[model samples]
Target: MAVIPVAIAGAPYEVRIKAGILAQAGRHCRPFVRKNRVAVVTDEHVAAKWRATVEASLAGEGIASQWLVLPAGEATKSWAHLAQTVDFLLGQEVERKDNVIALGGGVIGDLTGFAASMVKRGCGFIQMPTTLLAQVDSSVGGKTAINTPMGKNLVGAFHQPSLVLADPLALDTLPLRDTRAGYAEVVKYGLIDDAEFFEWCEANGEKLLAGDAQAREYAIARSVAAKARIVAQDEKETTGVRALLNLGHTFGHALEAETGFSDRLLHGEGVALGMVLAARFSARQGLMHGQDAERVVRHIGAVGLPASLRALGLDCDGRRLADHMLHDKKMDAGTLPFLLMRGIGQTFLAKDVDLGEVAAFLDEELAA
Candidate 1:
């Protein structure tokens, strides 16, 4: 087991990673779960796999779990489901002091955490992130949100989980495609500021994707520790320090919006492609070497992630895609800050980016 601490001043918590943490969830959650019965929010797909395991674990600790299983997918992260989840929790009589469990991938964690944030002015929640993407990134950051018609994660709040229990064994049940999508986030930490870790990923990412337990454990621990350090420093993203975490996200979110936030483009897939574009765009702007940009594209492509925008076969023009970014939540003062790379491990936010130039570059990329 690896215990990484997220020291967010007033709301410090621990992200516990292990091979079978889900099976031992009750033992770990005993301190935070005050009631004899707790409410668990999950999606239909996840419930089919791990619901019984979680229920049994909680039962062993003399706790009864009342579940609200929702339909799975990006669409579930909406105002409709948010109201449903909040209503379910209210019916369960959840109190602000009580902790509810968010069991599933990013969708469940984001929705449940957002629901918990609003219930009774704010309640607590536990994160049991089953997907590798959630375990490494979304589960720890407290950036709970739901996708809106305007954009992804446009409506939400910063509601930290009381504890995060990440079980590596959960990946054993996930589809290889989903696992690969999750791996994109693992690679992000390396691309963010850890060139050495990026090298480590270059050597071990295949093994990690192949279900090497040790590699999964190490990568999750390292990524969580990196995020914890950043979150502790800039909990609200007021400082540019925390904004560095959005390295591939600005571009990635735009891609998601253009794809209609559907399965046609998974969040990590968009991010993988977005990182490639950021790198290539950085090179185009004379901010990074062409060779360095190609290195990013190579790793992403080698991992079976989407590394090319043209391959997506989108019918829209570059201007239309850039228009989607206008609705991005990160937009401020009528300007969108772009995350561009000077090199791998050297990402910086560039606020002077011209959308028209980005459209031109996208046109070139679309043509290339």
Candidate 2:
């Protein structure tokens, strides 16, 4: 097991990455689970597939649990589901001291984490992220959120989990498409700042996607460690240091909004393409080498991820897409910052971005 500690203000937690760790969840979580009983919030898909294993794991250590299984999908992160989950936890007699276990992917983690943050003022929760997306990115960061009518993640909180158990085995059940999408985030950490790691990913990305256990574990550990270091420096993103993690998120969130946050374009797929756009835009702006930008796009495409807006066939123009970015949660005082690359593994926050120029760039990209 590889354990990475995230030291954030007010709360600190550990993200444990290992294969077949779900069975050990009970023993691993006993210390933080104040009550012998835990309320597990999961999605229907995950419950149908892995709930038995998770329940049995908890039961092994005399930890009884009540389950609040919800419908799976991006839509589950809504006000209605939030209320339903909180009500279910209340009915389960979940106290502030009791830990609420999030037993699914990003949807479950965000919804459950937001619910835990609000219920009884605040409560503890453990993350048992099943999907590759959750294991690497969403589970480590305290940025739990639900999409709103306005945009993705417009409503949420920063409630750190007590512990995070990312079992690569759970990913065995993940579809190849989802695995590839999740690989985008793993590659993201490398793109944000670690040139050597980026090179490693370039070489091993195919193997990782092909289910090489050694490669998967190594990638997860590296990604988690990178995020842990950034979160420790800027937990709430007050300082600009942590914003580097959003290397592709600004453009990616806009793509997500354009796709209605649906499966039409998975979040990581959007990020994959978004990172390419960021790289290309940086090159266009003379900040990065053109070949370097092409390399980023090529690698993302090589892994079967979308690397261009033209491929998505969205029925919108640059101005329309740029409008969506105005709703991004990262917007501050009506000013949006773009994470632009100076080169591979060299990204910087560019607050001087002109939305008009961005629209023009998107127009060119869409025309491509």
Candidate 3:
């Protein structure tokens, strides 16, 4: 198992990556578990596939657990589900000192973590992310939240997990569409600053999707390490260093909002398309050569991800879509900082972005 440490100030955690690590979850989690019992919050899809292994592992360590399995989907990330999760934890008699295991994809992790942060004022939680997307991105960072009518993750807290067990074998059972969505985040790390890694991704992305264990592990480890370093520096994103992590999120979130956060466009899919838009917009702003944008679009497209907004076929124009970003969480003093690129592996946050120009630019993109 490879352990990547996230050394955020006053709250450090470890993200463990390996194949078949699920069976040894008890042994791996023994140190941080404060009580002999834990409450596991998961979605039905994940519970069906991974609950037995997780429960057996805990039982092997003589640890007892209670589980709350929710419906599977982005809809699960809401006030109703949040209330359900918190109430379930309370009913399980979980204490502030006991750990609550978030044993599913991003939805479960976000809802459970946010609940743990709110329960008894604050409680301990463990992240056992099952999907590639969760394992690579959402599982490590302390950011936790459920979507509100206002926006995606507009209401979340920074509650880091005590331990994260990411068993890569989980991806073996994921649907191809879901795996491809997760790959978008994987590519983001490369586009953010690791050009060579992006090159590696261009070479291995298909293999990773085809169940290449070695390739998958390498990508996950590299992405996790990159995020860990950033989170350590700016845990709360106060320094904009961590903002680099939002490479494609601004436009991506707008796509998500336009889609009503539905399955019509997955988060990673929107991000895949959003990164392409960012790259092209960078070229338009004279921050980089148009070839760089084309390269990004080509690499992401080669992986079967949607690299253009036109692929989504929304009945809206770019200006309407751009209006959605007005609700972005990154907006401060009415100035939203956009993450743009100078070249592959060279991304920077730009606050001088004019939303009107962005709308006009999108009008051109949608028309294209």
Root-mean-square deviation per candidate = 0.7, 0.9, 0.9
lDDT of 2 by residue, 1-368 (tens): 89899988778889998898998888998897877888999999999889899899899998998998899999999999999999998898888887889999999999999999988998889999998889999998788889998999899998999999999998889999999989999989888999899999999999999999999999999999999999899988998988998878888989998998899999899889999999999999999999999999899999999988998998999999999999987799999989998988888999999999999999999999
For model 1, residues 93-187, the per-residue Cα lDDT tens digits are 99999999999999999999999999999999999999999999999979999998889998999999999999999999999999999999989
Model 2 poorest 10 in a row by lDDT: 29-38
Error of 2 at 118 (Å): 0.3
Query: How does each model score on lDDT?
Result: 0.93, 0.91, 0.91
| lDDT, candidate 1, at 217 | 95
Candidate 1 global TM-score:
0.99
Best by lDDT: 1
Give the least accurate 10-residue stretch of model 3, judged by summed lDDT: 29-38
Q: What is the lDDT, from 0 to 100, of the residue 310 in candidate 3?
A: 75
Better of 1 and 2 by TM-score: 1
The better-scoring model by lDDT among 1 and 2 is 1
Taking all chains together, each candidate's TM-score versus the true structure is 0.99, 0.98, 0.98
- Candidate 2 has an lDDT of 0.91
